[model samples]
Target chain A: MSKGRIIVIDDEDIVLISCQRALAPEGYDVRIVKSGMDGLKMLESEAFDLVLTDLKMPDIDGIEVLRIVKGKWPSVEVIIITGYQTVETAVKAMKLGAFDYIEKPFTPEQILSVVKNAIAHRASE
Target chain B: MKTKVKKTLYSLTGKLILTIGAMMIVGSITFWYFLIYYQERELLKNSVKYSLSFVDYVKKSTRYGMLTFQQLLIQQTVEAIGSAEGIMRVRIFDSKGKVAYSSKKEEIGTILGKNDPLCRSCHSESVKPRDMQSWSIRRDPEGYRILNIVQPIYNEPACYTSYCHVHPKEQRVLGLVESDVSLSLLDKAMKRQKIAITAFVFGFICLISVVLCTILWNLVSTPVSILTQGMERVAAGELDYTVRIDTRDEMGELARAFNAMTADLSKAKKELIEWGNTLEKKVEEKTEAIRKAHEQLIHSEKLASLGRMAAGVAHEINSPLTGIVTFGHLLLKKFPEGSQEREDIEVIIEQANRCSSIIKGLLGFARATSAEKSSANINDILNSSLNMVRHKADFFNIKIVLNLDESLPSIRADASQIQQVFLNMIINAADAMDGKGTLTLSTRKVVENGNPFAEIEFNDTGHGVSEENIPKLFEPFFTTKPVGKGTGLGLAVSHGIIQDHGGKIFVKSTLGEGTSFFVRLPFYEEKA
Candidate 1:
C-alpha cells in the first residue's frame, strides 16, 4: 500500500508536477490536477487522505474547493499553496478548517515534510 | 454717568439757550431802562406845564387886587388859590422886593431881597424884566416838594391910567406873584409807575427768553442730538440706526447724509463678514486637500523606492529559486547519505530557502497600497489580530490585557490590511519583550482636529525601543532584534498599509518602561 493518498491542484504545471514528484518517492500515492475543478472531480471519483491546492486557479478558486472538500470529506486534510499576493487569503483559508499552508517557491523536502506530518496527523485522528 | 451729565450741560442746546437768553435779558433791561427814563422826563415836563398855568391864573387874579390897592383882596386871592389842590403857598412880591401879600400869615409882612431864594426866581439879575416869569422846585422844611412860580405884573395902559398909578407914563412897574405847589402826590404816582413798569418788563423778558429757547432747541439742539445719538450708535457697531430729523434745514440734510453713511457701513460690514466666513471655509477645504495630496505623495514615493527595485528582482529570483530548491532537493537524493556532493547540494538548497523567505518579505514591502476598503470595526480587527498572535504570545509568556471599547465606530478600511498592521505591532512588542511581558490591546473612539476616528492601541510592557532608534523603526531592514529573529519589514509594511487606509500610526516608548503604538483610522461617513 502507498504511504498515503494525496491530490495536488495548481494552475501552474511546474507546481503541480513538482508536488507529485516530490511526494511520490516519499511513499505517498500522489495525484496531480491542473485546475481546482479537475481536483474536485478527482476527489469525488476517488478517496484521498490530503489535498494540496493552489489558491488562484483558472476554473474555480482554491477556497471554494477547500470548502466543498471539508464539507463533504471532513476527515480529509487540505494544505493551501499561496504566492506572495495570496498569502493573506491563505491565512483566511486556515480559519476555514484548512490544515496548514505552504508559500510558493517552496522546496521538495519542505512539501514532503509537511505532507508526512499531515498524513500522520490524519491517521492519528 | 458724570460725563454724560456734563456733556448735556454743555451740549448745543444748553449753549444756544444760554447765549440767546442772555442776549434777550440784556436787550429787555436796556429797553426797560430807556422807557423808565422817558416816562420820568414826561412826568417832569407835565409838572412844569401845570406850574406855569397856575402862575398865570394867580397873576391874573391878583392883578385886579393889586391895581385897586386892596391888600386884603389880594391876600384873600393868593390864599384862595393856595388852598386849591396841589398848591402849597402863593404870595405876591411888590416891585420893591417886599412881600405885599402872603398865603402864610407869618410871611405877610416879610421883606425879601432880590438875591433871596424866594425872590431870586424873578430877580436873580437886578431888576431884569425878562426874569419876571420863572418856575423853581424846592423842598420845604416840612419835607414837602414844592414848585415855585413867579409872574411879574407889568403896568398896562389901564394900570397907568388908574388912580393907583405912581410913575410917569413911560415907567414899567411890576410885582411878582409866586406860587408853591406840593409835589408829594406826583412823587407817589411816579414811584408806582416805576415799580409797575419794572415788573412788566421783567415778565416780558421771561416770555421772550422762553420763545427764543424753544426756537433754538428745535432748530439746532434736537436735530443735532439725533445726529449725535445716531453717530454714537454707529460707532458702537449698530450701523442700522438712522437719525430721524424732519426739518428741511441744514440739520436735516446732515441727518440724511448720516443715515446714508450708516447704510453703506452696514452693507460693507455684511460683505466683510461674508468674506470672512467664505475665507475660513476655503482655507479648511484647501488644507484638507493638501493633506490628502501630501499623503498620496508619501505613499507613492515609498512605493516607488521599494517597488522599483523589488519587482523584477523578486520575480526573477522567485522563478529560479523554485527550480533551484526543488531540483536541488531532487539532486541531493542522488548522492550518498554522508557524501560531500550531497552536503554541497544541501548548502545550495539551504541558501535558496533563505532567499525565498527574504523575497517574500521584500515583496510585501514593495506591494501596492491599494487596499480594498470596507466598513470595518477597529475592535473586531484588534480581536482578530490578537487571535493570530495568541499562540506566539503564550509561547513567549506574554499576558495580554484587553481594554476594548464596545462603542467604537466602524472605519472605512481594508479589514485584512488593518489586522495585518495590528499583527505587525503586536509581534514587534512581543519580540521587544524578549519572551516575558504583558501587552494591553485596546480600541476606543477618538476625535482629532474635529474628525472622528477609531483608535487601536497596543501597549507593551517590553524592553522598550530607545529614543535614538524610534525614528528608524518603520524603515525596511531596520530592526533592533537579532538578525534571524526578525525580517525587519513588519513595521515598514504596517506603516504603508495604515497610510493606505487613510490612517496614522504613532509610537511612544521609554528605554525600560514600555512602548505604546497607536493606530488611528477615520470613522466612515456614509454621505455620497
Candidate 2:
C-alpha cells in the first residue's frame, strides 16, 4: 500500500510537477492541482491524508484553503509552500493550524523528507 | 504703551501771543507818552503867557501906589487883584526884601530873605529850580496846587524924586512880587486826559491779544498740531496716515509732502516684502533640490557597492558552499546508517550549510531588508538584542552594562531590522573589545530642533579608530578586520537601514581610548 494520501497545490505547473516527482517514488500517494480551488475539490472527492499548498496563487490562497480544510476535516494536516521568507506569514500560518511551511527552491530530498515527516505526524495523531 | 505728552515751556501759539502783546504794549506806551508830553508842554506855555501879562498889569497898577508911598492904596490894589478868580495870593516886597504889601493881610508884615526861592529868582539869577524853569508851583495848606509867578520891581525916576527916601538911580531892581495862581482846573483836565489814555491803552492791548490769537490759530497753531500728529503716527509706523491740514499755507504744503512720502514708503515696503518672500521660496527650493540630489547620490553609490559585493559573494563563495553541502549530502546517502563515517559527513554538511546560510544572510543585507515599520520601543529592542549577545559577551569575559532610559519614546521602525542592526553593533563592540573589556548599551530621548528622536548608543572599551579612518567607517566593504574574519558589510548595511527609517547612524572614536556607535530614530506620533 502507498505510505499515505497527499495533495500538492500550486499555480506554477513546474512546482506541481516537481512535488509529484519528489513524493511519488518516496512511497507516498501524491496528487497535484494547479489551484487552491482544485485542491479543495480533490480533497472533497477523495480521501486525502495531507495537503501541501502554495501561499500566493490565482484561485483562493493557501491560508483560506488551509482554514477550510481544517474546519471540514480536522484529521488532515496542511503544510504551506511559499516563495516569501518572511517570518510573519509563517507564524500566521502556524497559528492557523498549518503543520509546517517550507521556502521555495527546495531539493527533491528536502521535499521527500518534509512529506515523510508530515505523514508520520498524521499517523501518530 | 502710550506715553504722556509733556507740556513744553512755550507752545507756538504762546510765542505768537507773547510777541504780539509785547509790540502792542511798546507801541501804545510810546504813542501815549509823546502825546501826553506835548499836551503838558502846551498847558505850561499857556499858563506862563497869562502869568506874565498879569504881572505886567500888576506892575503898572502898583506904580502910583509906590510913588505915593500910600500903603493903604497899594494894599487895596493888591487885594483886589489877588481876590480875582484863579488867584491864590499876591505878595509885594520892597528893595530891602521886606513884604511891604500882600494880598494876604496876615503876611503883610512878613520879611522875606534874599535866599528864599521867591527872592532868589530875581536876586540870584544864576540858578533855575530843577524842573521849575521860571515859575514855581506850590501846594496850599489844604493841598490845592498853586503856580507862583515872580516879577522884579524896577527903580524909576519918580521913585527917586519921592519924599520917602528912594533908592539911587543905579538900582535896576527894587523888590519881588510873587503871584500864586490856582492850578486846579489844569490839574482836573490833565487827570481826565490821563484816564482816557489809560483806558485806550487797556482796550488796545485786549484787541491785540484777540486778533493775534485768531490769526495764529488759523494760520499756524491748529494746522501745525494736526501735522505734528500725523508725523507722530508715521514715526510710529502707521505709514498709511495722512496729515489733515487743508490750509493753503506752507504748513499744508508740508503736510501734503509728508503724506506723499509715507505713500511711497508704504509701497516700497510692500514691494520689498514680496521680493523677500519670493527670494526665500526660491532659496528653499534650491536647497531642497541640492539636498535631495546629494542623498540620492550617496544612496545610489551605496547600492552600487552592495551590488558589487553581492555579485562577488554569490558567484565565488555561494557556488563553493552549495557544492560542498551537495557533495556531503550525496556522501551521506552512500554511507551506512549510524556509522562513524556517516556522522563525520553530517558534520561537514552541517558546517557547509551554515556557510551557505551566512552567505544568504549577506545577500539579504544587500537588499537592506524592505522595512515593515511599526511603532516600536527602542529599549525593548535593545533588551532582546542584548539577550542574544549576552552569552557571547560572557564567554569572552566581557562585562555588559545596560543604561536604558525607561522614558524613551517609541520610534517608527522595523523591529526585526532594528534588531539586526543592534545585534550587529553588539557583536562589533565585542569584537572591538577583543573579549576583554566592557560593553555599555544605552537608550535615551533626545530632541533636536524641536523634533524628538530615540537615541541608542553602544560603547566599548577597545582600541578606538584613528581620526583619518573615521569617515570611511560606513562605506561598504571597508573593514579593518583580517581576511575571512568579517565581510565588513554589517555596519554599512546597518547605516543604510537606519537612514531608510528616517534615522541617523554615526560613530565617535579616539585612538587609544574607546569607541561609540550612535543610532537615532525619529519619535513616532500616531497619524490621524
Candidate 3:
C-alpha cells in the first residue's frame, strides 16, 4: 500500500529541506514549500493526508493554513511547527483544528512519533 | 525704601541733639532774665543812697557859710569867705531881705524881698522862722534849694550900761545868709551807676550763653557725632563697631539702646544668611535624590522589558533547533550502519546538539535566568500561572482565553516575577467575576508618549474596579482581591517594571462590564 502523502511548509530553506529528507525514507511521499502561500496552492491542487506547517511565516501564517485545511479538507491531519515555542500559539493552533504542535530543534524521534500518531489516527477514522 | 526710612527714624543722634539744643535755649533765656533784673534793682538802690548822702553834705556846708557871714564885712575877708568849702555863692540880706554884702560880687547890693517865694515863706509873721532851722525850695529851672536861719545882729549888750538896755528893746535882723549848690553832681553819679549795672548784666548773659553752648556740645553734639560715625560704618556693612558714650543721662541711655539694637540686627542678619544657605543645600539634595530615583526606575524598566521579550527569543531559537534535532535524528535512524552518510549524520547530530545548547543559552538570555530567571513565553507564563489555579477556575466555570499577539517581541525578564504577575491578574479577574467569567489575555505593539513599546493586556468580563480604586490600584498592597488570594504586589511590581522601561501601565474598567490592564514597555530594536 502507498504511504501517506505529507506536505511540509517552513519559511527557512534548511528546515524545509531537512523535513523532506527526514520523512522521505520513512515510506511516505513528502512535498516541501518555503512560504505559506505556496503551501496553500499545493494543498489546493494536490492531495495530502497530513500537512506540517511552520507557525510563523510571511504573507500568511501556519494558523491560517491550518484553518483552511480544516475547512476544505477536514480529513487531513494538520501539525503546527514553530521555532519559538509558546503556549499561546500552541493553544491557538489547537483551537483552529491543528492536530498537534512541534517545537524547533526537536529530536527525530519526537517528530516521527507525532506524525505517525496523526497518521494512525487518520487511518482509524 | 523701607529700610532707609526705618534707619532715619530710629537714629539716636537726631533725638539727642534735639533735646540738648532745646535745654540750652531755655537755660540761656532764664539766665538772661534773672541777671538783668537783679543787677538793675541793685544799681537803683545804690544810686538813691548816694543821692541822700550828697544832700546832707550840702546842708552842713550851708550852716558853715552862715557862721562865716560875721567876717564877711571886710572885702578881703568876704573874698576869702566866697572861696569857702562847698559854698558856690553866699550873701547877707538886711531885715527887709535885701542883699547887703555878697560873696558873688555880681549879686552884691541886690534886693531880696518878700516877692521871692523862698523869702516870703521863710519870713512870714505866721511862720516861726527862729524855731524852723531850714527850708527847701522846689521850682522849675530854679531846681531845688534849702534855706538856713536868718540871725538878729545887735551891738554887744553892756550889762550895766543904759544904752545896752535900750538896744535890747531895739534888736535888728541881719541879712539872711544863702548858699547855692548845683544838683548836676548827684545826677552824674546816678547816670554812672546805671551804665555800670547795664555792662555787668550784658557780660553775664554772654558768659551764660557760652557756657550753655559748651555744655550742649559736650553732652549732646559729641556723643551724637560718634553715633553718626558708627551708623555710617553699619551702613557700609560693618557690624563690629561698638558705640561708647560715658554719660548717665538720657543720651547715654539712648546710645546703650542703639548698641543693643545693632547687636540684635547683626545676629538676625547672620541667621538669615545661614538659613538661606541651608535652604539651598536642602534643595540641591532633594534634586539629586530625585535624579537618582529616576535613573533607577529606568534601569528596572529595561530589565522588565527584556524579560518580556525573552519569551519570543526562546521560541525563535527553539524552532530552528527543533528542525536540526529532527534532521540529525532522522539521519541516525536511516544510516545506523557505518557509511559516509552515517559520519555526516553523526556530525549533524553533534552540531544539532550544539545548536540546542545555543538555544538553551538564548533561552537563558531571554529569561534573565542567571539570577533566578528562566525563559518563558507569555502564553506559557499565563498558562502555568493559571494552571496552578486552573482547578479553581474550572470549578467556578471560569473560561480563560489568551489572545497573545503573534508578533510579540522576545523579552529578557525574570520568569517567576512575570508568573507572579500573571497569577495575580488571573486570580483578580476570576474573583471579580465571582469565579464565573471570561478572562482574556491580549498583547499588542504600542507606542506611549512617542516611545515605541509592547503592550500586554489582561481583560476580564466581570464586575469592574470602581473609579475610586483605579488610582490606588497599582499602589503596593492595594487590592480588591480577597485577602487570601491576593498579596497586592502584582500590579505594583508590574507598574514598577513598566516604569523602569520608561513606559506606563494603566487600567480601565466599567461598572458591571469588565476590567482591562495594559502594561507598556519600551521597544527593543534588534541590533544589526
| C-alpha lDDT (0 to 100) for residue B463 of candidate 2 | 92
lDDT of 2 by residue, B1-528 (tens): 122212321777777678878888988989889988999889978987898778778878988888888889999999999999998788887767788888999997777776876666645767552223257777777676778887777677888778886677788777767788988888788879988998998898888789888998778888878888888888898988887877677988998888899999999989999999999999999999999889867775866576557745643554344345545655677889999999999888766665655555566565564788988889899999888878753435888888999988777889988998999898888888788788898888888779988889999998999999997787776788775566677887788788879888989998778899999999878786
Q: By descending DockQ, how would the candidates be arranged?
A: 3, 1, 2
Candidate 1, residues B122-200, lDDT tens digits: the string is: 5566556464577777886766577777777777787778797754567565667777888888877877888888898
Compose the digit string of candidate 3's lDDT tens values, residues B268-371: 98999999999999999999989978876665565456545645666666656666666667657777587888888788777767656545433433433223
| Top DockQ hit | 3
Q: Rank the candidates by lDDT, best first.
A: 1, 2, 3
User: How many pairs of residues collide in model 2?
Assistant: 0
Model 3 error, position B228 (Å): 5.2
**lDDT per residue (tens digit) for residues A3-44 in model 2:** 999999987766676677667866789999988899999889
Model 1 chain A is weakest, by summed lDDT over 10 consecutive residues, at A12-21
Off by over 4 Å in 3: B1-281, B297-528
lDDT of 3 at B260: 88
State the TM-score of the second chain for every model: 0.55, 0.56, 0.39
TM-score, chain B, model 2, is: 0.56
A1-125 per-residue lDDT for model 3 (tens digits): 55799999998877777777677777879999988899989999999999999888888988888888899999999998865434457788898888998777777667778899999999999
